[model samples]
Target: MNPLLQASPLPLFDQIQPEHIEPALDTLLRQAEDALSTVTAAEFPATWQAIAAELDVATEKLGVAWGSVSHLNAVADTPELRAAYNTCLPKVTEFWTRLGADERLYAKYKAIAPESLNTEQRQAHKNALRNFVLGGADLQGAERERFAAIQEQMAALSQLFSEHTLDATDAFSYYATREELTGVPDDVVQGARNAAQAEGKEGYKLTLKMPCYLPVMQFAKSSALRGTLYRAYVTRASDQAEDTAKQFDNTDTMRSILTLRKEEAALLGYPNFGALSVVTKMADSPTAVIRFLRDLAAKARPYGQQDVADMRAFAAEHLGLTDPQAWDWPYIGEKLKEARYSFSEQEVKQYFTLPKVLAGLFKIVETLFDVEITPDTAPVWNPNVSFYRLERVGPQGR
Candidate 1:
């Protein structure tokens, strides 16, 4: 049996596998298409309940199933799972595009009487009408088709860019000797040593993962090591990655994505992509956002410039580093903080172990909200992930 076909409140991550993705997606897509057909039929009742019961239930199921696959691809990606996700992504994208473009479905949503609905239904109806207009539901033949095509293409390109970035990040590993790791924190060094030992290699292994990369940049004594790792980190998904063969360049992908977004907005009668984005968001207008950002930047620029100058002066006078570059920023910050404040970030980090932090956080939340949260070992996609459940406690609660 396909585990994905089994209905549950949450995904059965314990049973889901890469092999199940394609079949599950195909079945769910078919079901969703059939549901839309029912909802859009000529004789279908133009009522919220009719639409919700027939179409919304099927759509939610499809979303949940597909969401599980995509989430797993992000958190626990292997070659097989990645392949399956990439293969199914287009089909999923196409289904949503087709549904959104179905003028009949949009009309069905429009045909419902707002006065007949409860508050929730009325709110949903208002949103549905606005979204239909935004979705180009009223557009003529060629334009509507183009709009759907843009959505499908953009979805594919966005997924590709993300995959390439992740693959590029996972492709490089830097091995460092004990001497090169001087001034690095004990925990970071131990983690790096463990990484190398995991592969039966000697010395420390560093990667672009934030936990290792950030610490090394801030504390490693070797300027060469910091500069090399920083360059590799920033140039990920570009041609400049250390693993040249696995560059996973996103330059073309990003260009295509931006072009498509602009075209999509123009097709919908919006001046630009930013204008289209703000339609569904809280922002009033693109110009408003731009002005706000500019004003905020103007206010912060003075303090920011002074910060840079202070750091540059300190680095020159105390560290014997007359010149500093992009890679030197974190190292300088760490040194400056210690010299000025007599405290190091590593010292702070050591006192707050992961378990201690989580326990303290849970205590704070429980006290503040009068609720409970506990670890739920209900099979997560990644072993490192922790799932928790929250529930209200009544006066007689145990």
Candidate 2:
């Protein structure tokens, strides 16, 4: 059996390969399409449970299988895996676009009587109705066709943006001499050295991955080194990057995404994308959200201003950095924090081992939620990922 087609509760992560993607998705999508036809047939009842049993089950399987593929692509991307995902992306996108905008299915859903549903069912039905509208179920003729096209285009563009970001991030590397790595934490420097050795190189290797970038910014004594990294970090997937990196620039992609969003919003009778976004959210409108943010900023402005002033003074007097640049803030802040608190992140990290931290976290969660969490076995893509079982802490101990 294809691991993607396995009946296991969790995905068979270790067994699923790039080759399995197309066949698995083909079968799942066919099943989902068949289910949609079944549910929307003239003889079929428009009741919630009937449609759910046929349509929901098939679609859920498709979702889970696709989600697994997407997760693997994000965490453990390879050229083959990426190619497989891209090949299948448009098919998956098209199916979902059609399903959401199917007028027959929408009519069946409309035929479902709200009075027949219980409290939970009613809420679910209400949300589904709203979603169908937002999904362009009410659109007709050319407008509907355009809406579907826009969805597929947006999906493709979004995936392209993600690919560019990941590629840009992975493409960058900087090798620094031991003298250049001065004041960097011991573990980080050692890790960098190990990376360089893995590639048969002499000096320490550094990348923009957060583990290396963040600590380097905070603690590296070399201002030039910090500046070099800061520039690369900020300019990834942008035109500001070097010639090779400029190929991954998202400037045009971002503009196209925004243009499509505006068009989509207009098609759905929304003024702008922001207005459409809040329809499913708690905020009444975009204006309300903006007002709330402005109010928050007003309240926070004084403290933020004071913090900057204090950091500036500390940088000028103690560090002899009268003209601190953007890259200097994190270093100055860390130094200031260490001076005032008489502690550093490096010192704090020594006390909180991974095991100790996990124990503390689980203890707090178990106490608050009245549950017992225990280790359980499952196939994982990575060795570091451990599975756990959570049970209610009751007399029956389920």
Which candidate's TM-score is highest?
A: 2
Hey, what RMSD does candidate 1 come out at? 2.1
- Give me the displacement of residue 10 in model 1, in angstroms: 1.5
Q: What does candidate 1's lDDT look like per residue over 1-398, in tens digits?
A: 88788877778887889999999989999999999989899999999999999999999999999888888888888889999998998899888877776889988888898899999889888988888888778788899888888888998888888889888878879899999999999988999999999999999999999999999999997889999898888899986655573459988898999999999899989899999999998889999999999999999999999999999999999887789989999999999999999988877887999999999999999999889998776666667778898876669883
lDDT of 2 by residue, 1-398 (tens): 99999999999999999999999999999999999999999999999999999999999999999999999999999999999999999999999999988999999999999999999999999998888999999999999999999999999999999999999999999999999899899999999999999999999999999999999999998889999999999999999998799999999999999999999999999999999999999999999999999999999999999999999999999999999989999999999999988879999998999888988999999999999888899989999998888889988767
**Could you tell me the lDDT of residue 226 within candidate 1?**
96
- Give the lowest summed-lDDT range of ten residues in model 2: 389-398
By summed lDDT, the worst window of 10 consecutive residues in model 1 runs over 238-247
User: Which regions of candidate 1 fall more than 4 Å away from where they truly are?
Assistant: 242-246, 363-371, 392-398
Candidate 2 lDDT: 0.95
Model 2, clash count? 0
TM-score of 2: 0.98
lDDT of each: 0.89, 0.95
